[model samples]
Target: MPDGPNTLLDLNQRSREVFRQLVETYLATGDPVGSRTLSKAGSRTGGVTLSPASIRNVMADLEELGLLSSPHTSAGRMPTEAGLRLFVDALLQVGDLTDDERAGIESQLSGSNRTADGPLAQVSQTLSGLSHCAGLVVAPKRQARLKQLEFVPVSPGQTLAVIVFEDGSVENRIIDTPRDMPASSLTMASNYLNARLKGRNFDEAQRRVQQEIDARRAELDELTTRVVEAGLAVWSGTDAVSGSAGRSLIVRGRANLLEDVQAQEDLERVRRLFNDLETKEELLQLLTLAEEAEGVRIFIGSETKLFSLSGSSVIVSPYTNAENQIVGVLGVVGPTRLNYARVIPIVDYTARLVTQLVR
Candidate 1:
């Protein structure tokens, strides 16, 4: 075995071919691959013709190079994380998804509008179910600039804050008015804010209103300002319902993680990974890797801390809107020994399909 990080670079042609073939087989099946198995596999050209003893010597060399690990009982070897990365970057040959797979994806993605629930969530769930892996999606921000506001009295002290965006999407939040504040006062506050902010962005309008309040320039009582601030706070905080640019995450197939054979060691780690996926913020941070990546991004074991504990892998791709702007991310999470050659291209194609559908 070579002494350093450049070990793979120093390997002879035959040894390199043998290592690559072993890594490929191990990736396809999460099990140790023996030399005899390689010899009898018939997939390789003429590289596997060596005797079993000769192949074992090569396997020992690969194990020393940090590319393969030999189990105590089995006379076979499996690729390590470093080995998998090398194979993924230099040795793996990714193939295109078949037409049947594409049609199945299309059929699953089409279920979004057929139900009352959000389409993006449906897409995420469907992707997870089809892949037999965890699926995640950053939901699209559908809210546009706020265009109009209306307040209607639903009860004595409660009014519905109807917010209309430039995109024609509308949302309402029930706000509690001051017990002594009259309906007329609420209308005055609504009108004042609309006149100053009808054509402006929500965040910008919020900042301007805050500045005005700070300067004591707007002619209004403290109570009216309080009511306006309360209404805006509710709207801003619930961006999902209001269609603002706040982040959203949906994850499915967490149960698939438990099926991993290696996860039997300290299952708590996998539990943390699953729990982290539930929160929108933490999940967004994980998906943020896809934002900076070009096309598709693959995180194979220990490449990211969020997934390191689970000893899992993630493949993500960004999906864009009609304007060619990246609107969200979609991807799958599975065991590290997953079929990267197959899944990588599948994920890349799924990202493109999602972009087309959203457009």
Candidate 2:
């Protein structure tokens, strides 16, 4: 046994080769790889002649170093979370997506008559089908610059605030109005905001409006000022109907998590995972971390708090806008035994396709 930094660099060439082969086999079959299996699978180890006894000695050393684990009295061994992390970080060789896959992804996302919902829905489904795992995407928040603002009377003390964006998107919010406020006050506030806030984002418009009010440049009665403030606040706050800072979270293929359940413990873990997905807050926070990542980010078992109990892994990559600003994140969630060599590139390509389509 060779030891130094406890990484792949620390292992002797033969030991590294054996460990790599064992992890690959376990990932493929989701079963432990015994020393005898390694001996028989000589081709996987570069035709190295390793007897079962010799393989067993290496497996024991790996287990002692916390890289492998044994279940019950089985002679085989499976990679631990740490082992999977090490392999993903160093030993794995990523594969490219096939031409058919690239075409499929491009066709789905790059339709001529595409609506926001259509591309996003198809992307999630495509990812789920290709990866055989649950697909997850943190949809970009639809924030548009102010094009027009209108206040219409709804009832005695309620006014409807209709916001039209530069992109032609429209949203309506009901705001409480002072009963004594005159109908002309609505027009006054609407005209005032439209002149100053056009083509400005929500934050920028709000700041400019407040600055004007503080400087006392615009002459207005207290009632009209309150009406203008209320109108701006509605759009500034999150769209309550959609939730999550106006961003949508898409999760598909959750049933895939249960397809391979072989025990009560496995079923319980799947149930927990389903519950975790339902709580979108945690998943949103997890995906937000990918915004700062340059490319793909892998979170193995126990590394992410939300999946610690479920022992799941997540692979995420951020998709950017034309300006290279990250607008959203897309990824896959599955068991630790997922084929990272294949799935990693699939995610990478999907993210790039999404970015292009978004632009």
Which of the numbered candidates is closest to the native, going by highest lDDT?
2
lDDT of 2 by residue, 1-359 (tens): 22223477778888788889999999999888998888888856455469899989988888877788898898899998888888888899998888997897777667634765667777777788889999998888666788999999989999999998899988898988998779999999999999988998877888888898889987777878888888877666443434455467899899888888988888988898888888887788888899876899999978999999988999999999999999889999988899898889989999998898888
Candidate with the greatest TM-score versus the true structure: 2
Evaluate residue 346 in candidate 1 and report its C-alpha lDDT on the 0 to 100 scale: 72
- Candidate 2 segments whose C-alpha is farther than 4 A from its true place: 1-6, 43-48, 150-161, 173-196, 209-245
Query: Each candidate: what lDDT?
Result: 0.76, 0.84
How many residue pairs clash in all the candidates, one count each? 1, 0
Deviation (Å) of 306 in candidate 1: 1.0
Give model 2 RMSD, 1 decimal: 3.9
